[model samples]
Target: MAKSLKSPPADLTRISTRNGGTFPLARISKVISGEAQLPGGHGNREMPVWGPFFSRVDADQDLGRMRVDSLARYLRKIQQP
Candidate 1:
């Protein structure tokens, strides 16, 4: 996944991370739903706010093709406000 300097869509619910990473929750939902893909190969310079910087792919893979109904609630509990 090449990091996009381009702006993300307006309607997305984005979770901003350190080092210029913004993971749109809806887009990630799409990824998990098979409506999209988030392939590996982008480096650790940036990553979805979900996991440790070095292994974001593993985190994403763990959520693959599965619907996690409480993603926002889960993320909210774990992540800083």
Candidate 2:
């Protein structure tokens, strides 16, 4: 079964904002694709590389792309107005 897309937790979002994490969709897409590193570089030390992690879960590039796209879209939707 595929993992469902969901908004990030409010605490995490708040922390990101506190730490200067406002990234545009294009950059967010790159982060999702693993083409570009996340801002601040902490993800490199603390978290699994999402691109590879998501890929390993299903081992399907197309499905991984869909999942990443869905997540990126969700992040975009939650930006402060």
Candidate 3:
């Protein structure tokens, strides 16, 4: 996962059909909300899906949201200018 994240495709706007994956870094919020979809109906590439994973971790909606937000913010911060 670290390797993949460290070397994402140069063009994030384009979706890759071959791998059934999407770089939600540019739109992290949508991905977190399950509003993003991939080919073959596979949801966001992140296994276990962070939204549900965070919810299960604490069973608190606010805490889950905080976790997702923190992740999204981190992604945004690391993006190249």
Candidate 4:
């Protein structure tokens, strides 16, 4: 006889603020595929996801850190009041 696995309880901590007020799996898949707009009209199509990767590269010892430091310094200067 094959044993049946019981279904887990629904997670109550999840929340959403979009039109449906829930992050449906289908919508998340669409967003991942660059076919859906996020809340407030923002979408992944307009932004490149490279900041964290560059940060990691900046911290690597084998790569030159001077250019990364210079870019960081420039960004800090631009953000100064």
Best by lDDT: 2
TM-scores for all candidates? Answer: 0.31, 0.57, 0.51, 0.27
Error of 3 at 50 (Å): 1.3
Clashing pairs in 4: none
Tens-digit lDDT track for model 2 on 1-81?
Answer: 123423222333343365476546666666767778655564333333577677777768778777778887787666653
Instruction: List the pairs of residues colliding in candidate 2.
Output: none
RMSD of each: 10.5, 7.5, 7.4, 18.1
lDDT of 1 by residue, 1-81 (tens): 234634332222334443146545665554334344444423432324332322344567554333343453454345432
List where candidate 2 sits over 4 angstroms from the true fold.
1-23, 42-45
lDDT of 1 at 18: 33
TM-score of 4: 0.27
Which 10-residue span in candidate 4 carries the lowest summed lDDT? Answer: 1-10
Cα lDDT, model 3, residue 37: 52
Give the residue spans of candidate 4 off by over 4 A. 1-22, 42-81
Cα distance off (Å), candidate 2, residue 74: 0.3
The residue-by-residue lDDT of candidate 4 on 12-72, one tens digit each, is: 2332332245445554433333345643453223433333444466566434333344443
* Candidate 2 vs candidate 4, lDDT winner: 2
CA-lDDT, candidates in order: 0.40, 0.60, 0.54, 0.39
